[model samples]
Structure formats: C-alpha cells, structure tokens
Target: MIELVLPARRKDLGGFEVGRVLPAVLKRAVGPFVFFDHMGPADLPAGIPRTVDVRPHPHIGLATVTYLLDGEIVHRDSVGSEQPIRPGEVNWMTAGRGITHSERFEKARAQGDHVDGLQAWVALPEADEEAEPGFVHVDAAQLPAFGEPGVHGRLIAGSALGLTTPVPVASPLFYLHLELADGARFALPAEHADRAVFVARGEVEVDGQRVAAGHMAVLATGRATDLVAHGAVTVMALGGEPLGPRFLEWNFVSSRRERIEQAKADWRAGRMKLPDLDHDEFIPLPGDPPPPPNPMS
Candidate 1:
C-alpha cells in the first residue's frame, strides 16, 4: 500500500527560499539521502534589494548535491573549488571530516531571475564518513538521458535505467530527474531497497494515489509502482540500500553524536578549515545549546 505522502515545509532563506520535503515525521531518510530541499520557483524582481548571500558555513559527514532547474548559483568551498552551477548541471560537495562553503546568486542573474532547484544531502557510509573533504562538478551534457518519447529521465547520480551518471559517489544509490508529458507513465525500478518520489511541479499519480506538487511519496519496499503524469510534470526519484542509523545536528550529519560534538568544537575554536577567499566571513555558531535529541531516534 504505498500511500504515505509527506508535504514539504517552506523555508525562507532571505534572497531566496526552498521547500524541505524529506525526513518526515515517521521517516528520516530514503536510502542514504538524509536531507532533501526544493529551492525556489520564486522570481526576484528587478531593481529590488532581493539577493542571495549565503555566508561561508561548515558541514561534516555528508555530501551535498545541488541540481538546478532554473537560474544559477556560484559555489565556493574550502577545497578551493569555485564553480557556477546552472540548469541541468550538478554540484557535489563532500564534507567528510569537515568543510566550509558558501552559495550565492551570480550578480548578473540576481537582477530579476527565476530560481528553482533541489539540494540533497547524502550521508556518507560509516567507513567514508571521516575520509576527506572533496568536490566535483558534472555538467548537464555529461549525464545520461533515456525513457520513452514523451517521458524523459536524466540519471543524475548513481546507476538507473540501464545507465550510470559521471557524478562520483562512494555508495550505491540513485537520484533521477524525470520530465513527463501529459499521460506519460514511468515504472519504478525495483533493484533498490528503498524508493521515494518527490513531485516538483504539476500533478502525478503513483500507484493510483494523487501526488500534488510540493509533496513526497515514500513508496513501499519490495514492490514495483508506476507513476503516471496527470499533466506535464517534473519529479525526482531517489533510492538505494539503507545505511545504518545516522545523526543530524544543523549542518552536520554523522553516525555518532560525539563526532558531531567534535565538529562543533572545531568550528567554535577556529580549527575548522575554510577557503581563503571567503574565510573572513564565515558564519559564527549560534549561541544556543547543542541541537535537541534526534527525532528519528
């Protein structure tokens, strides 16, 4: 009975905003993806002060994958990687032990541009959780695309639909972006142990239940399901074998709370590293106590 649907909660981040659709009340993760954020569909008008200026921030024990549907964002990381990601391109940053980074809209596009995208945080496997911070940029043309005439799929990461993306990953998982014409149908792959669908725009029906835009349908395991588009729609499919339980605290995610604590101390003591370009503007930790107990625990 794959009927569980979790609605996204809107989050406002000043110049831009996003809808967080994952880690629902009963579910914390789908496969290795612990955090899923749907960014924008918002249009910043010209001549206004609307802008995006995310200051340098630190993260640990996970990889962040940013895929844009519209607009652009410039990514700068402690590893000295500076890349501007546009529509269909992907920015993958792994914060193993710890890393600092920032995201901001390009000056040219900040003046009246439509911004829309999805950002997913995939937790590293236990062995690779503390490896080394790294970054990779995969251009739009590099990803594989397939499916029927009206329905198209881009294998953004991992292997799916008889194709594998160039995006480097330390674990087995699938992150797919799908575009469906009216009445198009897509059958879910069954090789993965966990599966979920997030409808970004338009309407869709998965296994006979309507999934409106801004909602995520966490499918049941061990059975196949078909997704039919009620109209032109965009949806993201995610799944993989489950990693063990993981803990999350603000920007940090790890299997052990002690590791998160250590990361916090390192940031507070200025021991955490950041890129020289933006290091001077790193965000200071909030004065609140450590994050509350893990809701998924």
Candidate 2:
C-alpha cells in the first residue's frame, strides 16, 4: 500500500490554532480539495474571553465547506444568507463567480466556550466556475447516518457507502465524518479516483501504517484499504477524481490566471460586493511593494 503522510502546520488565529494540512510543499491538493484547515482543539481557559471572528472576505470559483466538531458560528454572505451553523451541521457556500462573506463565533456564546472545526475549499469545474453564487445549510439530521456494531458515521458531503448527502456539490467528490470504536475497522471504496483519511483524534492504522492525530494519509489511487482504530477515534475521509489544474491566488480560484488577477483588482478597488450586514468591514489587500535595497551588501 502506498501512503503519503502530510504533517499539519499550525497557524495561530486570535486565541486558537488551526492546523493546515493541504497545499503542502510535497502535495498541492487532493482531487478538487485545494485547501484544508483543522481549527482549534484548544480550551478558552476561564476568565479570558475571545470570540472567533473572520471578517468579510471574497472568493471566486470555489465552494467553502465548514464542519464543526464543537461550538457554533454564524455565516453571512452577500446573497443575504444569515445562518447559524452548529456541530455536525454543514454550511456550504459556493463562490461560483464571486462572493464575500464573514464568519463569527455565535454572539450568544458565553465566556470560556470551546470551539473546534474543519474548513475546506473545493475548486469548481471550469464550466461552473462563473455560475451564480449561492449558500445552503444542512442540519445533522438531514444527512444520512449509519452504524454497525463498532463503526458509526455521517455523510458530510458527496457520496459514499451507496448513500449521498444533501449538501450541494457541482462535481464528483466525497467527505465523510466517521467515529470508530477500539479495534473497529472500515474499508475504503475504490470508486473515488483519489482518497485520504485524516485522523482527527485518537490513533488509527491505514493499510497497516500507523497514523497519529492531526496527520493525514493520502491513499494510493484506486486502492482498497482498511482503516482500523486502535482506540475510540474520529476520522475524516475525503477525495474525488481530479478537477484539473486550477490557479489559486489569495482567496480566489479559477482555471485562468487572469480571472484571479481580476478578482484581486476588484477587491482592492472596493468594487467587490459584500454581505449586506458586514458590508462595512473587510480585510484589505496585502501590499507587495518591492523590498528595500539591502543595507549591508
């Protein structure tokens, strides 16, 4: 069995740490999944109050998938969506052409509240890259859930196990949230051209190789393998066939480099629209002026 282990790099945001796994030096992407971030398994530590806030930002030619293991977030988009997403639920926002949005920890959260989640960016097919933007939220109950003796799981998106999720996706793909009891094992489907398993917590072995928490194991293409949990464990299985080459710049994604540059210009010129409520605030463009000449040459 061929396996490529991707170590996560921690990025600090306010009071939390997000482990970035995809777009690594060795691997740029897994199928259409171009960006993957595992946020916070951190505690708030009493007497300190911090609210997760991601100001309004723009995106193009991709869909954002937000899945939470704990805590809640309110999502607002230019399409007039103001939805509160909770654990086990899904918030899928497609920036087909262009869209701006913001995510903030639910205002009702009390001090010392805990938060943790996973966020990913899936590039859209070239044909639908300029389709109208949209947003949808699916509750945990609306998704298919199944269990056998020692394994339980929910279809977070795409298709798996002869079942499909309600989350709208433009291309072929799969994302599953699974929990396994000690000694339990589950087999991978060969249908998806690409596949990987992320050990969210606890310990697991994929095709006989040990994978620790916070690490991802990319499986060999079209190979059938088994993942066995050494103890109670949580895993995220995600992948699909290739979406072809995509140009990713800042928060924009497109098949053409010019589209990304156009998006950047639009954002910097204050021409990009934003959510009705969060229209007043946004992250500014990062300046890239030429570096000053070296002084000690």
Candidate 3:
C-alpha cells in the first residue's frame, strides 16, 4: 500500500537546478537514506565558467552515492582519489570519519552540457560511524541486470531479482534502477520493511493514484504493490532496515550529537582537509557557528 508522496524541493543553482526529495519536514528519511538530490536534466552552454562547479566540501558519518545518467564528472578527494564518473557508473564515497571532495564538469558538450542524475547520502550505522574513510567506483557492467528485454532494470545494491550487486554497503538495503515501457506494470521488492520509489523522468501509477516525475512514493511494505508507467519511465526503487534515530547538521550525520559538534568544530577550525586537486577553494560552513543539530526521525 502507498503511504505518502513527497515532491522534490527545486533549487536553482545558476544554470543548474537540483531537486531535493529527502530530509523534508514530513519525513526525515527512507531507511538509511538521509539526503537525496536530483541533479540536472539541465543543459549548460559551452565554455561555461568554472564558478558553477561544486567547490570542495566536507562530510562525515555517511556515504555519498553519485550516479549519472548523462554527461560526466571528475571527482577529486582528499584521500588522493581522482576518478571520473560517467553515465551508468556509481561513485560511492564513504566519509566515515571525514572526507573532502569536489565534482568538476570538464566534459561539457560543445553546444551545451547535459547533466542528469541522482546523489544520495546514506547515514552510517552507529557502530561504523567512525570507521576509516574510503572511495570506490563501480561500473555499470558490474551491476546485476534483470527484467525482460523491453522492461529492463539494474540492481545497484543488496539482493533483488535473485541477484546481488557488487556495490559495497554497510547495511542491509536494496537499490534498483528500472525502465518500464508504457503500460507495463511491476511489483516492488517486499523483502525490506521500509521502501520508496522515486520517479526520475516519468509518471507512474501506484495504488490507483498518479505520481509524476521528480516525486517519490513511500510504500508500506509487506503486501505487494504494483507500479504502472503512464509512459516510458525510469525510476529508482530503494530502502531497507531503518538505522534508528540520527542527528543531522549541515554536511554531518551521526548517532551522537556530540560527534556532529566535533565535525562542526573540525570544519570551522580548518581541521578538515580540502580535496587534493581542488584545494584552491572550499565551501565555508554556513551560519558560522551553526545552531544545535537536531535529531532526525
């Protein structure tokens, strides 16, 4: 059964716009996913200034999952990792203690650069919150593929369709990307107690209600629920066991509020290192001494 539908809060970043769907006032998260951003399907003109690039930023107690559907991004991190992620590839960076990184678009198209993809932050388990930081890139070919020829999909993590993906995860969860032909109906995996589906580029029908693009439907798992595409659609199906209450502050997430305070102190005092390649600039912590972190549901 369907529970609630959340709309992405659109934010315009000069030539690009990001749609944020998670961590809203209504619901803090879906399973371990604490933050979710839908990056452009926007086109940037040739020779666009580099000022628009994401400056090096710091994160802790979570993993940044970057997947591109179009265009390219050069990822540089403080761990001496420099990787380029293209369409159908997954860039998973775990900032257990702390990590800094930046994403630059040097592969801008001649006429314009087409960027479209999703970035999600999964909060770490309490026991692994302070583990070592690391980064890994998984190719599209390595992800397990399933579904009929016309209705295809890929398992990005966990077990689904009797296949498990190679993407490393710290918890029990499943993430999937699906392409459904118009009028084709599909059942979501019921193994997880908490789950939701985000419509990235098309509308879908769930529980006799229509959910348009840039929106997500949180489902009450146990019984089966079928989603039918209104047209050709691509969606992300994700969720798993809950990670309990978490404290969120700026770019930091932790089970302990004092840990968040420590991260704030580290970034404010320049204790956190910036990305190796993009060390020339870094995003300053907003609000200087930010307000007390809050416990997220």
Best model number under TM-score: 3
lDDT accuracy of residue 284 in candidate 3: 74
TM-score on alpha carbons, each prediction: 0.93, 0.93, 0.94
Report the C-alpha displacement of residue 115, candidate 3, in angstroms: 0.5
Which residue pairs collide, candidate 3? none
Q: Taking the tens digit of each residue's C-alpha lDDT, what string does model 3 give over 84-181?
A: 89988899999999999988777773345789999999988989999899999999999988887458898877777688887779998888899999
Ranking by TM-score: 3, 1, 2
Model 1 C-alpha lDDT per residue in residues 172-256, reported as the tens digit of each score: 9999999999999989878788889999999999999999999999998888889999999999999898898999988999999
The number of clashing residue pairs in each candidate reads: 0, 0, 0
lDDT of 2 at 214: 93
Cα lDDT tens digits for candidate 2, 198-225: 8889989998999999999999986787
Error of 1 at 292 (Å): 27
The global C-alpha lDDT for each of the candidates, from Candidate 1 onward, is 0.87, 0.86, 0.86
* Residue 42 error, candidate 2, Å: 2.5
For model 3, the run of ten residues with the poorest summed lDDT: 288-297
| Higher-TM-score candidate of 1 and 3 | 3
Two-way lDDT contest, 1 vs 3, winner: 1
